[model samples]
Target: MSGEVRPRRADAQRNRERILEAAEAVLAREGTSASVRAVAGEAGVGLGTIYRHFPTQEALYQAVIVDRTRRLLAEADRPSPDPGTAFLTFLERIVVHAAQKKTAADLLAGSGVDPKAGTADVSRDMRQAIGRLLTAAQEAGAVRPDLRAPELLALLCGVCLAAERDEWSDELRRRALDVLFDGLRPRPLS
Candidate 1:
């Protein structure tokens, strides 16, 4: 056989997608105690099928995170009539994801998996995507001129980590995001 890996059959690919969706839901609800068997059951697939696709819980969680991040980045890259709204919406969506993804993230951290282990490329793409949104917002006078992508990313991570750590209520999360976004807005001067 050639060195190149063969593409999955359509059914296999479909099953993999279903497993990821179900895994996300199960992990979000079950926290660090979720099992591959539970994911297989949730996906309506056999244990062998899940093992064939993802040999370990770490592998499964990493794949789910990478899959979700890529989808979010795709949405962030789309054109929007209001760059400011798009940028803020992206940040908000990330915070919401943080809340849903806390269990998986904590599990990964506890497993000694470097947060960036399999996600370096996606992380770079995410930064670039955020930079593009920030630039557009700055040009539109929707955000302060002094802000950079790194600082924005830092702020975003802080709030996401806080939201996850504190288990903030939806109302509190929205209020916190409002405060953060408000700080990003440009200040009028005399």
Candidate 2:
């Protein structure tokens, strides 16, 4: 037989997608307490299948994160009439998603999964998209010129963490975003 491998069969592709979806749900629900067997059960697949695809918990988690990151990056890449508003909307979405997936977020934070490992390219693309948005906003004089993409990323993560509290509400998140976004605006000269 040739050394070249054939493409995955349609059934195999379906199984992999099912596994990823199940893993996402399980991880979101159980956090670090989740097991590969649990994911296999959720996916209605054999443990061997999960191993054949992921091999390790870290790899599975990385795949889920990369998928989510790709969706977020797509959102950030869309053209907007007002880049400042779009950026703020994107931050709000991050906060909402983080709140909804608090367990997953916590699990990833403590799981020793290197953020820059398998996600470097996607992360770089995300950063570049955000940088372009920030630049557009700054040029429009809607945002402070000193604001940077890295700082905004950090700030969004902080906001998301804060929004994960039990008492957190949409109003609270809106207020927090308002305060943070205000800080990104250019101050009026006296």
Candidate 3:
């Protein structure tokens, strides 16, 4: 009688990682609907192998989220000399790059995903980092002291949500963000 298929080898495990990496590139650069078979081909693996590692669409999507989280966290950990500028720049980068990564770009599109589903903790950490910057900025009178973390995140959500379907160019987005920042900046009354 024929036996069941054997488990994958070490090389097979490495190949699976490569496939996931390729899938990430495709999904981020393209969209969430990228084909699994196409990913296997890109990874130089067979269809059966792709099926072996991730048997379901949800599994693949989760993997994409986890991988993207790692990448974003790594980016967040990069050295920044100024906490305030870094905070604002990080938020701006998150907004622009959200549309650049398929997993997050789609999430930013209001796919009805739970805000803290997989990446909530990472977000909380990011907000804490920004909060520290916020405090520093307020002390320096560069930003309004009344602003709160949740409020800031909500405003960012608004920017990402509105910008997703807009016809604005990158330059336009940057300029528009500058306008938004102008409103948020502290000003002395005459």
Candidate 4:
């Protein structure tokens, strides 16, 4: 036989996707203590199916984190007509993800998974993306000229942690973000 690897079977692929989706939701709702059995029930699959796809809870949670981060980065890379809107949207999504995945994150931290696995390159890419968006918005006069990418990243981290801690509702989160975004906007000369 050749040393080539093969793709997953169609049904198996579907099951895997279903399992990840269910795991994402369960982990978000139940936090770090979320069980593979609960994910199986949520996905309408058997425990064997979950184990077949994930083997361990840490692996499953890590996959979920990687998948979600990849999706978020993809959206951040998309071009938008309004630079400010794109920047704000990206930050808002980050906050929402943090708030939703707090428990999942804790689980990874406690599971000896390093919790940062699979994110180093993604983090660099994210910083670059944020820089581009921030520069564009600043050039468009939609953001403060003095605001730097590092500062913005730090602020984003702060907001994300706060959101995760406070567990804000969707409405409150939007309102709070609106306030934050407004603060980032350029001020008119007196």
Indicate which candidate wins on TM-score: 2
Per-candidate TM-score against the hidden true structure: 0.75, 0.78, 0.70, 0.73
Top of the candidates by lDDT = 1
lDDT of 1: 0.78
| Candidate 1 colliding pairs | none
Clashes of 3: 0
**Who is ahead in lDDT, 1 or 3?**
1
Once fitted onto the true fold, the runs of candidate 1 whose alpha carbons sit more than 4 angstroms away are 1-18, 30-49, 103-116
Tens digits of per-residue lDDT for model 4 on 124-188?
Answer: 66677778888988888889999986567777777776777778899999898888888899888
lDDT of 3 by residue, 92-172 (tens): 776776656534433333323466465555455555655676676677677877887667766776776555445347888
User: Which parts of model 2 are misplaced by more than 4 Å?
Assistant: 1-4, 7-11, 31-33, 102-116, 164-168
Cα-based lDDT at residue 116, candidate 2 = 51
Worst 10-residue lDDT window for candidate 3 reads 104-113
In model 3, where do residues sit more than 4 Å from their true spots? Answer: 1-10, 33-48, 75-81, 105-116, 162-168
Q: Rank the candidates by TM-score, best first.
A: 2, 1, 4, 3
- Residue 63 of model 3, lDDT score: 76
